[model samples]
Target chain A: MPAINLLDKFSRFSDQWSPKVIAELNGQAVKLAKVQGTFVWHDHAEEDELFFVVRGTLLIDFEDRETVRLEPGELYVVPRGVRHCPRTEGEEEVWLMLLEPISTKHTGEVEDARTVRTYDRL
Target chain B: MPAINLLDKFSRFSDQWSPKVIAELNGQAVKLAKVQGTFVWHDHAEEDELFFVVRGTLLIDFEDRETVRLEPGELYVVPRGVRHCPRTEGEEEVWLMLLEPISTKHTGEVEDARTVRTYDRL
Candidate 1:
Protein backbone atom coordinates (compact mmCIF):
# COMPACT_ATOMS: atom_id res chain seq x y z
CA MET A 1 0.00 0.00 0.00
CA PRO A 2 0.98 3.62 -0.44
CA ALA A 3 2.03 5.88 2.37
CA ILE A 4 -0.89 7.38 4.25
CA ASN A 5 -0.73 11.02 5.23
CA LEU A 6 -2.30 11.64 8.62
CA LEU A 7 -3.37 15.18 7.84
CA ASP A 8 -4.82 14.22 4.49
CA LYS A 9 -6.84 11.40 5.98
CA PHE A 10 -7.91 13.72 8.81
CA SER A 11 -9.11 16.30 6.30
CA ARG A 12 -11.39 13.72 4.67
CA PHE A 13 -13.57 13.45 7.73
CA SER A 14 -15.10 15.87 10.25
CA ASP A 15 -17.30 13.69 12.39
CA GLN A 16 -16.65 14.10 16.06
CA TRP A 17 -16.30 11.09 18.35
CA SER A 18 -16.10 8.85 15.32
CA PRO A 19 -12.75 7.33 14.47
CA LYS A 20 -11.57 6.39 11.00
CA VAL A 21 -9.22 3.50 10.44
CA ILE A 22 -6.05 4.39 8.59
CA ALA A 23 -3.97 1.23 8.89
CA GLU A 24 -3.69 -2.09 10.64
CA LEU A 25 -0.71 -4.08 11.78
CA ASN A 26 -0.17 -7.07 14.04
CA GLY A 27 -3.92 -7.34 14.67
CA GLN A 28 -4.01 -3.72 15.86
CA ALA A 29 -5.98 -0.99 14.16
CA VAL A 30 -4.56 2.49 13.69
CA LYS A 31 -7.31 5.06 13.81
CA LEU A 32 -7.78 8.81 13.59
CA ALA A 33 -10.51 10.68 15.37
CA LYS A 34 -11.74 14.25 15.76
CA VAL A 35 -13.14 14.43 19.22
CA GLN A 36 -14.95 16.98 21.33
CA GLY A 37 -16.98 16.87 24.56
CA THR A 38 -16.63 13.63 26.55
CA PHE A 39 -16.56 9.95 25.74
CA VAL A 40 -18.02 7.12 27.74
CA TRP A 41 -16.40 5.80 30.87
CA HIS A 42 -15.62 2.16 30.19
CA ASP A 43 -12.90 -0.44 30.27
CA HIS A 44 -11.50 -2.87 27.78
CA ALA A 45 -11.27 -6.20 29.52
CA GLU A 46 -8.60 -7.62 27.24
CA GLU A 47 -7.02 -4.89 25.15
CA ASP A 48 -4.82 -1.98 26.01
CA GLU A 49 -5.76 1.22 24.24
CA LEU A 50 -3.18 3.69 22.96
CA PHE A 51 -4.06 7.34 22.50
CA PHE A 52 -1.74 9.61 20.58
CA VAL A 53 -2.69 13.24 20.32
CA VAL A 54 -2.14 14.80 16.94
CA ARG A 55 -3.51 18.27 17.70
CA GLY A 56 -5.21 20.20 20.50
CA THR A 57 -5.49 18.63 23.94
CA LEU A 58 -7.21 15.55 25.36
CA LEU A 59 -8.16 14.90 28.94
CA ILE A 60 -8.58 11.29 30.04
CA ASP A 61 -10.59 10.97 33.18
CA PHE A 62 -10.37 7.80 35.18
CA GLU A 63 -12.59 6.31 37.83
CA ASP A 64 -9.83 5.37 40.27
CA ARG A 65 -6.85 7.43 39.14
CA GLU A 66 -6.02 11.01 38.42
CA THR A 67 -7.02 12.34 35.05
CA VAL A 68 -4.28 12.55 32.44
CA ARG A 69 -4.08 15.48 30.07
CA LEU A 70 -2.50 14.79 26.68
CA GLU A 71 -1.10 17.43 24.35
CA PRO A 72 0.18 17.43 20.83
CA GLY A 73 2.89 14.88 20.11
CA GLU A 74 2.11 13.18 23.41
CA LEU A 75 0.82 9.67 23.95
CA TYR A 76 -0.76 7.67 26.74
CA VAL A 77 -1.79 4.07 27.10
CA VAL A 78 -4.76 3.13 29.23
CA PRO A 79 -4.11 -0.37 30.39
CA ARG A 80 -6.69 -3.04 29.88
CA GLY A 81 -9.56 -3.10 32.39
CA VAL A 82 -8.94 0.51 33.46
CA ARG A 83 -12.06 2.62 33.47
CA HIS A 84 -11.46 5.86 31.60
CA CYS A 85 -13.10 8.62 29.63
CA PRO A 86 -11.54 10.98 27.09
CA ARG A 87 -12.60 14.58 26.60
CA THR A 88 -11.55 17.89 25.12
CA GLU A 89 -11.76 21.16 26.98
CA GLY A 90 -13.79 24.07 25.56
CA GLU A 91 -15.10 23.89 22.01
CA GLU A 92 -12.00 22.96 20.11
CA GLU A 93 -11.84 19.50 18.65
CA VAL A 94 -8.93 17.23 19.50
CA TRP A 95 -7.23 15.24 16.82
CA LEU A 96 -5.98 11.81 17.82
CA MET A 97 -4.28 8.73 16.46
CA LEU A 98 -5.28 5.62 18.34
CA LEU A 99 -4.05 2.00 18.44
CA GLU A 100 -6.10 -0.89 19.72
CA PRO A 101 -6.89 -4.49 18.97
CA ILE A 102 -9.31 -5.15 16.17
CA SER A 103 -11.80 -6.78 18.49
CA THR A 104 -11.95 -3.86 20.88
CA LYS A 105 -15.32 -2.21 21.16
CA HIS A 106 -15.85 1.51 20.84
CA THR A 107 -17.38 1.76 24.29
CA GLY A 108 -16.34 -1.55 25.70
CA GLU A 109 -19.38 -3.31 27.14
CA VAL A 110 -21.40 -0.18 27.72
CA GLU A 111 -24.34 0.35 25.45
CA ASP A 112 -24.07 3.90 24.20
CA ALA A 113 -25.52 5.75 21.26
CA ARG A 114 -22.11 6.90 20.18
CA THR A 115 -20.64 3.42 20.08
CA VAL A 116 -19.49 2.36 16.64
CA ARG A 117 -19.52 -1.28 15.75
CA THR A 118 -17.59 -0.99 12.54
CA TYR A 119 -14.79 1.41 11.71
CA ASP A 120 -14.59 2.94 8.25
CA ARG A 121 -11.30 2.58 6.44
CA LEU A 122 -9.84 5.76 4.97
CA MET B 1 2.23 4.88 33.13
CA PRO B 2 2.79 8.57 32.49
CA ALA B 3 2.16 10.35 29.24
CA ILE B 4 5.09 10.07 26.85
CA ASN B 5 6.11 12.99 24.70
CA LEU B 6 7.64 11.77 21.46
CA LEU B 7 9.95 14.73 21.20
CA ASP B 8 11.02 14.36 24.81
CA LYS B 9 11.88 10.71 24.33
CA PHE B 10 13.65 11.57 21.13
CA SER B 11 15.73 14.25 22.85
CA ARG B 12 17.02 11.88 25.49
CA PHE B 13 18.58 9.53 22.95
CA SER B 14 20.80 10.24 19.97
CA ASP B 15 21.74 6.71 18.92
CA GLN B 16 21.30 6.11 15.25
CA TRP B 17 19.38 3.06 13.97
CA SER B 18 18.50 2.10 17.51
CA PRO B 19 14.92 2.35 18.72
CA LYS B 20 13.83 3.37 22.18
CA VAL B 21 10.62 1.96 23.53
CA ILE B 22 8.26 4.71 24.58
CA ALA B 23 5.22 2.54 25.23
CA GLU B 24 3.78 -0.89 24.72
CA LEU B 25 0.17 -1.89 24.33
CA ASN B 26 -1.44 -5.20 23.47
CA GLY B 27 1.94 -6.87 23.06
CA GLN B 28 3.05 -4.27 20.52
CA ALA B 29 5.91 -1.88 21.14
CA VAL B 30 5.74 1.78 20.30
CA LYS B 31 9.26 2.99 19.65
CA LEU B 32 11.14 6.09 18.62
CA ALA B 33 14.21 5.94 16.45
CA LYS B 34 16.74 8.36 15.02
CA VAL B 35 17.76 6.87 11.71
CA GLN B 36 20.26 7.86 9.05
CA GLY B 37 21.78 6.14 6.03
CA THR B 38 20.34 2.83 4.81
CA PHE B 39 19.09 -0.14 6.78
CA VAL B 40 19.67 -3.76 5.92
CA TRP B 41 17.12 -5.67 3.87
CA HIS B 42 15.08 -7.96 6.08
CA ASP B 43 11.57 -9.16 6.79
CA HIS B 44 9.65 -10.25 9.83
CA ALA B 45 8.29 -13.70 9.28
CA GLU B 46 5.24 -13.35 11.47
CA GLU B 47 4.78 -9.69 12.27
CA ASP B 48 3.86 -6.56 10.37
CA GLU B 49 5.66 -3.31 11.08
CA LEU B 50 4.30 0.20 11.01
CA PHE B 51 6.55 3.17 10.32
CA PHE B 52 5.36 6.70 11.12
CA VAL B 53 7.65 9.52 10.25
CA VAL B 54 8.03 12.25 12.82
CA ARG B 55 10.58 14.37 10.93
CA GLY B 56 12.62 14.37 7.75
CA THR B 57 12.05 11.81 5.03
CA LEU B 58 12.33 8.03 4.76
CA LEU B 59 12.55 5.75 1.80
CA ILE B 60 11.53 2.10 1.99
CA ASP B 61 12.92 -0.06 -0.77
CA PHE B 62 11.23 -3.34 -1.39
CA GLU B 63 12.41 -6.40 -3.21
CA ASP B 64 9.52 -6.66 -5.65
CA ARG B 65 7.88 -3.24 -5.46
CA GLU B 66 8.75 0.37 -6.01
CA THR B 67 10.24 2.35 -3.17
CA VAL B 68 7.84 4.09 -0.81
CA ARG B 69 8.66 7.55 0.44
CA LEU B 70 7.37 8.76 3.78
CA GLU B 71 7.34 12.27 5.19
CA PRO B 72 6.39 13.91 8.44
CA GLY B 73 2.86 12.95 9.54
CA GLU B 74 2.90 10.10 7.06
CA LEU B 75 2.79 6.40 7.85
CA TYR B 76 3.30 3.13 6.03
CA VAL B 77 3.03 -0.48 6.99
CA VAL B 78 5.25 -3.27 5.76
CA PRO B 79 3.43 -6.54 5.73
CA ARG B 80 4.91 -9.60 7.30
CA GLY B 81 7.36 -11.59 5.17
CA VAL B 82 8.04 -8.69 2.83
CA ARG B 83 11.71 -8.00 2.26
CA HIS B 84 12.29 -4.30 2.66
CA CYS B 85 14.93 -1.80 3.68
CA PRO B 86 14.58 1.69 5.09
CA ARG B 87 16.90 4.54 4.16
CA THR B 88 17.36 8.32 3.96
CA GLU B 89 18.54 10.35 1.00
CA GLY B 90 21.10 12.60 2.67
CA GLU B 91 23.06 12.86 5.88
CA GLU B 92 20.10 14.39 7.67
CA GLU B 93 18.67 12.32 10.46
CA VAL B 94 15.10 11.05 10.25
CA TRP B 95 12.80 10.86 13.23
CA LEU B 96 10.45 7.90 13.28
CA MET B 97 7.81 6.23 15.38
CA LEU B 98 7.51 2.48 14.91
CA LEU B 99 4.88 -0.03 15.88
CA GLU B 100 5.43 -3.76 15.75
CA PRO B 101 5.12 -6.90 17.75
CA ILE B 102 7.29 -6.97 20.86
CA SER B 103 8.93 -10.22 19.78
CA THR B 104 9.98 -8.81 16.41
CA LYS B 105 13.72 -8.52 15.84
CA HIS B 106 15.16 -5.17 14.85
CA THR B 107 16.72 -6.43 11.65
CA GLY B 108 14.52 -9.50 11.49
CA GLU B 109 16.77 -12.54 11.12
CA VAL B 110 19.62 -10.55 9.63
CA GLU B 111 22.66 -10.43 11.87
CA ASP B 112 23.98 -6.93 11.42
CA ALA B 113 26.06 -4.58 13.54
CA ARG B 114 23.19 -2.12 13.72
CA THR B 115 20.80 -4.72 15.05
CA VAL B 116 19.61 -4.09 18.59
CA ARG B 117 19.08 -7.06 20.81
CA THR B 118 17.12 -5.33 23.53
CA TYR B 119 15.35 -2.01 23.16
CA ASP B 120 15.92 0.53 25.94
CA ARG B 121 12.70 1.66 27.53
CA LEU B 122 12.58 5.43 27.65
Candidate 2:
Protein backbone atom coordinates (compact mmCIF):
# COMPACT_ATOMS: atom_id res chain seq x y z
CA MET A 1 0.00 0.00 0.00
CA PRO A 2 1.09 3.54 -0.61
CA ALA A 3 1.81 5.97 2.16
CA ILE A 4 -1.18 7.52 3.90
CA ASN A 5 -1.05 11.29 4.05
CA LEU A 6 -2.99 12.74 6.91
CA LEU A 7 -3.68 16.04 5.25
CA ASP A 8 -5.03 14.28 2.18
CA LYS A 9 -7.18 12.04 4.32
CA PHE A 10 -8.64 14.96 6.20
CA SER A 11 -9.57 16.53 2.90
CA ARG A 12 -11.71 13.54 1.92
CA PHE A 13 -14.38 13.87 4.56
CA SER A 14 -16.27 16.60 6.34
CA ASP A 15 -18.41 14.71 8.77
CA GLN A 16 -18.03 15.64 12.41
CA TRP A 17 -17.30 13.19 15.22
CA SER A 18 -17.24 10.23 12.84
CA PRO A 19 -13.78 8.75 12.78
CA LYS A 20 -12.26 7.44 9.59
CA VAL A 21 -9.93 4.51 9.97
CA ILE A 22 -6.65 5.03 8.20
CA ALA A 23 -4.70 2.02 9.45
CA GLU A 24 -4.70 -0.81 11.91
CA LEU A 25 -1.87 -2.74 13.47
CA ASN A 26 -1.64 -5.09 16.42
CA GLY A 27 -5.41 -5.05 16.80
CA GLN A 28 -5.41 -1.28 17.19
CA ALA A 29 -7.12 1.11 14.81
CA VAL A 30 -5.63 4.42 13.80
CA LYS A 31 -8.39 6.88 13.09
CA LEU A 32 -8.91 10.49 12.10
CA ALA A 33 -11.89 12.51 13.11
CA LYS A 34 -13.19 16.05 12.85
CA VAL A 35 -14.80 17.03 16.10
CA GLN A 36 -16.77 20.14 16.91
CA GLY A 37 -18.76 21.04 20.03
CA THR A 38 -18.86 18.64 23.00
CA PHE A 39 -18.69 14.87 23.03
CA VAL A 40 -20.32 12.39 25.36
CA TRP A 41 -18.81 11.56 28.72
CA HIS A 42 -17.78 7.91 28.56
CA ASP A 43 -14.86 5.55 28.77
CA HIS A 44 -13.64 2.37 27.17
CA ALA A 45 -13.77 -0.36 29.80
CA GLU A 46 -10.66 -2.17 28.66
CA GLU A 47 -8.98 -0.02 26.06
CA ASP A 48 -6.90 3.06 26.58
CA GLU A 49 -7.69 5.79 24.07
CA LEU A 50 -5.02 8.05 22.63
CA PHE A 51 -6.02 11.44 21.31
CA PHE A 52 -3.57 13.33 19.15
CA VAL A 53 -4.50 16.78 18.04
CA VAL A 54 -3.76 17.48 14.44
CA ARG A 55 -5.43 20.92 14.29
CA GLY A 56 -7.31 23.28 16.58
CA THR A 57 -7.56 22.79 20.32
CA LEU A 58 -8.95 19.78 22.20
CA LEU A 59 -10.01 19.91 25.80
CA ILE A 60 -10.66 16.67 27.59
CA ASP A 61 -12.72 17.11 30.72
CA PHE A 62 -12.31 14.44 33.34
CA GLU A 63 -14.58 13.55 36.18
CA ASP A 64 -12.02 13.19 38.94
CA ARG A 65 -9.21 15.36 37.73
CA GLU A 66 -8.29 18.49 35.82
CA THR A 67 -9.28 18.93 32.22
CA VAL A 68 -6.45 18.23 29.84
CA ARG A 69 -5.92 20.52 26.89
CA LEU A 70 -4.15 19.44 23.72
CA GLU A 71 -2.71 21.57 20.96
CA PRO A 72 -1.41 20.70 17.57
CA GLY A 73 1.33 18.06 17.64
CA GLU A 74 0.34 17.15 21.17
CA LEU A 75 -1.21 13.93 22.40
CA TYR A 76 -2.87 12.57 25.51
CA VAL A 77 -3.80 9.05 26.57
CA VAL A 78 -6.97 8.60 28.54
CA PRO A 79 -6.65 5.44 30.56
CA ARG A 80 -9.35 2.85 30.29
CA GLY A 81 -12.40 3.28 32.51
CA VAL A 82 -11.81 6.98 33.04
CA ARG A 83 -14.91 9.06 32.53
CA HIS A 84 -14.21 12.03 30.37
CA CYS A 85 -15.67 14.35 27.77
CA PRO A 86 -13.87 15.96 24.83
CA ARG A 87 -14.70 19.27 23.23
CA THR A 88 -13.27 21.96 21.07
CA GLU A 89 -12.86 25.53 22.22
CA GLY A 90 -13.11 28.58 19.93
CA GLU A 91 -12.22 26.64 16.85
CA GLU A 92 -15.01 25.57 14.59
CA GLU A 93 -13.62 22.08 14.35
CA VAL A 94 -10.84 20.03 15.84
CA TRP A 95 -8.93 17.48 13.90
CA LEU A 96 -7.83 14.47 15.91
CA MET A 97 -5.95 11.26 15.37
CA LEU A 98 -6.97 8.48 17.67
CA LEU A 99 -5.31 5.18 18.52
CA GLU A 100 -7.29 2.52 20.28
CA PRO A 101 -8.01 -1.19 20.28
CA ILE A 102 -10.40 -2.33 17.55
CA SER A 103 -12.73 -3.60 20.22
CA THR A 104 -13.24 -0.14 21.60
CA LYS A 105 -16.66 1.37 21.04
CA HIS A 106 -16.72 5.00 19.91
CA THR A 107 -18.82 6.03 22.86
CA GLY A 108 -18.26 3.05 25.06
CA GLU A 109 -21.62 1.82 26.41
CA VAL A 110 -23.38 5.15 26.44
CA GLU A 111 -25.14 4.54 23.11
CA ASP A 112 -24.92 8.16 22.11
CA ALA A 113 -26.34 9.18 18.73
CA ARG A 114 -22.88 10.21 17.60
CA THR A 115 -21.41 6.79 18.35
CA VAL A 116 -20.07 5.00 15.34
CA ARG A 117 -19.45 1.28 15.88
CA THR A 118 -17.75 0.51 12.60
CA TYR A 119 -15.62 3.27 11.17
CA ASP A 120 -15.28 3.82 7.46
CA ARG A 121 -11.75 3.16 6.33
CA LEU A 122 -10.15 6.14 4.62
CA MET B 1 0.11 12.21 32.43
CA PRO B 2 0.43 15.58 30.76
CA ALA B 3 0.02 16.08 27.04
CA ILE B 4 3.06 15.03 25.07
CA ASN B 5 4.24 17.40 22.43
CA LEU B 6 5.89 15.55 19.60
CA LEU B 7 8.09 18.50 18.72
CA ASP B 8 9.03 18.98 22.36
CA LYS B 9 9.84 15.30 22.68
CA PHE B 10 11.89 15.44 19.48
CA SER B 11 13.76 18.41 20.89
CA ARG B 12 14.67 16.47 24.04
CA PHE B 13 16.90 14.04 22.12
CA SER B 14 19.17 13.98 19.12
CA ASP B 15 20.43 10.40 19.11
CA GLN B 16 20.30 8.66 15.77
CA TRP B 17 18.46 5.33 15.25
CA SER B 18 17.75 5.09 18.97
CA PRO B 19 14.02 5.03 19.67
CA LYS B 20 12.66 6.64 22.79
CA VAL B 21 9.48 5.35 24.36
CA ILE B 22 7.07 8.25 24.71
CA ALA B 23 3.76 6.59 25.52
CA GLU B 24 2.32 3.10 25.69
CA LEU B 25 -1.14 1.59 25.77
CA ASN B 26 -2.87 -1.68 25.05
CA GLY B 27 0.41 -3.52 25.12
CA GLN B 28 1.78 -1.33 22.36
CA ALA B 29 4.53 1.24 22.44
CA VAL B 30 4.58 4.70 20.89
CA LYS B 31 8.13 5.73 20.13
CA LEU B 32 10.12 8.44 18.42
CA ALA B 33 13.36 7.89 16.56
CA LYS B 34 15.77 9.99 14.56
CA VAL B 35 17.25 7.86 11.81
CA GLN B 36 20.10 8.43 9.44
CA GLY B 37 21.78 6.02 7.00
CA THR B 38 20.38 2.55 6.28
CA PHE B 39 18.88 0.28 8.88
CA VAL B 40 19.56 -3.45 8.87
CA TRP B 41 17.20 -5.67 6.90
CA HIS B 42 15.00 -7.52 9.39
CA ASP B 43 11.42 -8.45 10.09
CA HIS B 44 9.42 -8.96 13.22
CA ALA B 45 7.86 -12.40 13.12
CA GLU B 46 4.70 -11.42 14.91
CA GLU B 47 4.56 -7.65 14.97
CA ASP B 48 3.60 -5.03 12.44
CA GLU B 49 5.32 -1.66 12.69
CA LEU B 50 3.81 1.66 11.77
CA PHE B 51 6.20 4.42 10.74
CA PHE B 52 5.05 8.02 10.57
CA VAL B 53 7.32 10.66 9.25
CA VAL B 54 7.58 13.64 11.54
CA ARG B 55 10.29 15.47 9.59
CA GLY B 56 12.50 14.95 6.56
CA THR B 57 12.10 11.99 4.23
CA LEU B 58 11.94 8.25 4.94
CA LEU B 59 12.37 5.48 2.44
CA ILE B 60 11.43 1.90 3.19
CA ASP B 61 12.97 -0.78 1.01
CA PHE B 62 11.20 -4.09 0.93
CA GLU B 63 12.45 -7.48 -0.19
CA ASP B 64 9.80 -8.11 -2.83
CA ARG B 65 8.14 -4.75 -3.35
CA GLU B 66 8.92 -1.27 -4.52
CA THR B 67 10.45 1.12 -2.04
CA VAL B 68 8.01 3.40 -0.28
CA ARG B 69 8.90 7.03 0.26
CA LEU B 70 7.29 8.98 3.02
CA GLU B 71 7.18 12.68 3.73
CA PRO B 72 6.05 14.62 6.73
CA GLY B 73 2.50 13.72 7.90
CA GLU B 74 2.69 10.47 5.98
CA LEU B 75 2.59 6.96 7.43
CA TYR B 76 3.21 3.41 6.26
CA VAL B 77 2.82 0.10 7.97
CA VAL B 78 5.36 -2.64 7.56
CA PRO B 79 3.45 -5.88 7.90
CA ARG B 80 4.62 -8.64 10.19
CA GLY B 81 7.28 -10.98 8.84
CA VAL B 82 8.07 -8.71 5.90
CA ARG B 83 11.76 -8.15 5.41
CA HIS B 84 12.36 -4.44 5.06
CA CYS B 85 15.03 -1.84 5.55
CA PRO B 86 14.54 1.83 6.31
CA ARG B 87 16.83 4.66 5.31
CA THR B 88 16.96 8.40 4.87
CA GLU B 89 17.55 10.13 1.55
CA GLY B 90 19.16 13.50 0.83
CA GLU B 91 18.27 14.84 4.26
CA GLU B 92 20.85 14.46 7.01
CA GLU B 93 18.29 12.93 9.39
CA VAL B 94 14.67 11.83 9.45
CA TRP B 95 12.36 12.11 12.41
CA LEU B 96 9.82 9.33 12.83
CA MET B 97 7.10 8.13 15.11
CA LEU B 98 6.69 4.39 15.45
CA LEU B 99 3.87 2.23 16.71
CA GLU B 100 4.34 -1.45 17.42
CA PRO B 101 3.76 -4.15 19.95
CA ILE B 102 5.64 -3.59 23.19
CA SER B 103 7.48 -6.90 22.81
CA THR B 104 8.99 -5.97 19.47
CA LYS B 105 12.77 -6.14 19.28
CA HIS B 106 14.54 -3.05 17.97
CA THR B 107 16.20 -4.88 15.14
CA GLY B 108 13.88 -7.88 15.02
CA GLU B 109 16.00 -11.04 14.87
CA VAL B 110 19.15 -9.33 13.65
CA GLU B 111 21.98 -8.60 16.08
CA ASP B 112 23.37 -5.36 14.76
CA ALA B 113 25.58 -2.98 16.70
CA ARG B 114 22.90 -0.30 16.41
CA THR B 115 20.28 -2.59 17.87
CA VAL B 116 18.92 -1.36 21.17
CA ARG B 117 17.44 -4.10 23.31
CA THR B 118 16.11 -1.65 25.85
CA TYR B 119 14.56 1.69 24.94
CA ASP B 120 14.83 4.71 27.19
CA ARG B 121 11.61 6.44 28.24
CA LEU B 122 11.62 10.16 27.52
Model 1 chain A weakest 10-residue run by lDDT? A16-25
Model 1 regions more than 4 Å off? none
**CA shift at B35, candidate 1, in angstroms?**
0.6
Q: Give residue B22's lDDT in candidate 1 (0 to 100).
A: 88
Worst 10 residues of 1 chain B by lDDT: B1-10
- Give the CAPRI rating of model 2: high
iRMSD per model? Answer: 0.6, 0.5
TM-score of 2: 0.98
- The digit string of per-residue lDDT tens for model 2 on A12-68 reads 999999999999999999999999999999988999999999999999999899999
Shift of residue A57 alpha carbon in model 2, Å: 0.6
Checking candidate 1 for backbone clashes, the offending pairs are none
